[model samples]
Target: MLGYAAMNRTLREHDPPRRCNRDMRKKTWQRDGIERAAELTEQNFEDLYAILQWNLDHGIYLYRCSSTLVPWNSQFELRELPNYERIASLAESCGDLIEANGMRLTFHPSHWCKLASESTDTVERSVESVEHHGRWLDLLGLPRSPRYGINVHIGAHYGDKAATADRFCKVVDNLPPRARARLVVENDDKESLWSVSELVEEVADEVQIPVTFDYHHHSFSAREHSYREAFALARETWGDVRPVTHYSEPARLHGDFDARPQEHAEHVAAVPAWLRAESDVMIESHGKEESLLRIQT
Candidate 1:
């Protein structure tokens, strides 16, 4: 099965704009007034349901959800605001619908999460970000498994790849069980850092963490690894669960293909010859669902 990331902007998009409230937007933590907050939360649930239902109806069973469902979420004072039970009920219903239809759901938190950072503050914030995503999965009643993989990239190499990966494992070891259970690492887009082969040798091979292979990253990095080798390394870590791969073409804004190698184009890349027919892949192009449908057809 194939999936696309976040919302399908090319498709009908509906969003309720943020409203004015007593909420303070600054260095400190504060929340919008309860009544206003509840309205926003309800809006989020409705938007998600609309996207999920649309995907099912249109024959796209796999989808990725945005991590910012609740603004200023865990840092704020609001938890179960105006109608906690009601929203939780709705979230579970959404989960049931996905499971009933055999849809695959995924979450990709922001790349700013760097658990391997040498700074104590960076590590703390990273842990919080990961926990927030895990909590959302809980609200949706999704099982803590690769079926709803929470994918993230290991951050900057910090001049010592081995030490950085070791720090990553240590931080991951202490994660809340639910967050740890859903965690999966992807090879970074930068060539000088963690390539697919290096990632397997350093982290996934040792800790049994699932590896999400990104073909664009591997290509841009100038790595000699083949798609078959990449798929084998990732699939071994995943075991019976289907391994996920990412596909994207480079967007050219200037001189040549190398100008913006890391940026995803607004359309699908050609389906590679080695892509396993039974494997699950997610389109990372800027066109979102439009790119995904293009490649599938």
Candidate 2:
């Protein structure tokens, strides 16, 4: 019932106890506390904690959280993993750990609408889903942990892209300003009419939200614009609130079907230089861990 701002204020007021627990202290240097707690929790918690622990151990503090698999399919009843309590507990625990480690956690909601047509149930559920997750972060006193982000497609243009943008803006306007601020629009695959530029052009004048640049989507969409151009457009459009860009290998097309992921050697080669200049990049690869290793190597 509380809007995101009030929820955040509540979380801040009820901040978790700061002193490290006996377990945290013992495992602090070993990076085993997160894993140990994860084993006691569910998969979502485990995954989140593992990522946090990995980042802490390696000193790569800046990272974001995404719920791509939380509500993995159209039937919202089925979650990727069943135990909600465990997931909630794990999230809370991870928040404490994150704070102790002096790191932040941001989130991205599932692309549920992308897989199905938009319906009242879909939109309402999506909104509810984000609020629910935000609460979990709040309960964990992590509402502000990663700074809460929900990335989404611009949706179909229907007959008019401007109308679609207006519709989305209205939808966004109704949300709690804190949540609205956290909501970011990502560039979609070629099938959609609303491109990143179009969405920005529509909302830039109205809201203070950022753009999420999906580089692979741009390549697959064949927008013919260079990465620099896209990046600059995002910067120009959003100003200080720059979009969080996604980088992944371009998918191959085989006839009407899309092929498995293919390596873009050139793209990979170019990332390091770009990354050096940028503050954040989310690797959206099927083989993300491997790709990160390759990038480092």
Candidate 3:
């Protein structure tokens, strides 16, 4: 099945502009505290249910939810939200739709989450970021597994590949079962950074985590492996589960020759047949659900 990331253009253009990524700035969070977070979180949760229902209605079951589903959740326990009960009830409703219809929902925490950072504070914050995402999935009552994966990239090499990966593996080994079981790493988009083969050998091989293949990133960091070869290696990491792959055409390829190679096109023309056949490909194009809809035709 094809999937789309956080936004849904069609829904966003609706009367009140439905969206699940409602968020607050730092000053706003500080001024209002948990109450404000509770309000936004409730709204976000409610819209998330709407979004999921829309996806199921459109036959797009794979969704990547926003990390801010519950804003400022890392600052306090989810139970501390004034509307926690209502929020939990709403989440269960979304989960029911997901499970009853065999849908898959996932989260990709922001790029700042760097578990492999040399600084202890950054690593701690990163761990919290990942754990909070896992907690959200739990509240939604999804099974604790990679199927509802929390995908991430080890975005930095920190000048020492061996040491960096060592830190990453240790952190993964120590994460609570909630985050650990659902963690999946992705190949990076810079040549100097991680490739699928490197992740397969360094991280997944050591920590038993699945590797998510990003099609656009492969060209930047192929590490001498063909796309099929890299994908096959990443696929092996998923074990019994269907591997998840991210697909997007570069905007440059889509006629904006000046656009960066990593910039996603507004909409993808078509997905490769083999990728559609084997994995749940999340269309990373800017078109979101509309992109999936276009290719479906």
Winner by lDDT: 3
lDDT of 2 by residue, 118-220 (tens): 4677778767666545554564565432244566676566677666677677777777644665666777776455555665678655665666677666764
| TM-scores of all candidate predictions against the true structure | 0.89, 0.66, 0.99
Q: 147-222 in candidate 3: lDDT tens per residue?
A: 9999998999999999999999999999999999999999999999999999999999999999999999999999
* Evaluation by lDDT, superior candidate among 1 and 3: 3
Candidates in order: C-alpha RMSD to true structure = 3.5, 11.7, 0.8
Off by over 4 Å in 3: none
The candidate scoring highest on TM-score is 3
lDDT of each: 0.76, 0.52, 0.94
Residue pairs clashing, model 3:
none
lDDT of 1 at 172: 88
- Better model by TM-score, 1 or 2? 1
What order do candidates take by lDDT, descending?
3, 1, 2
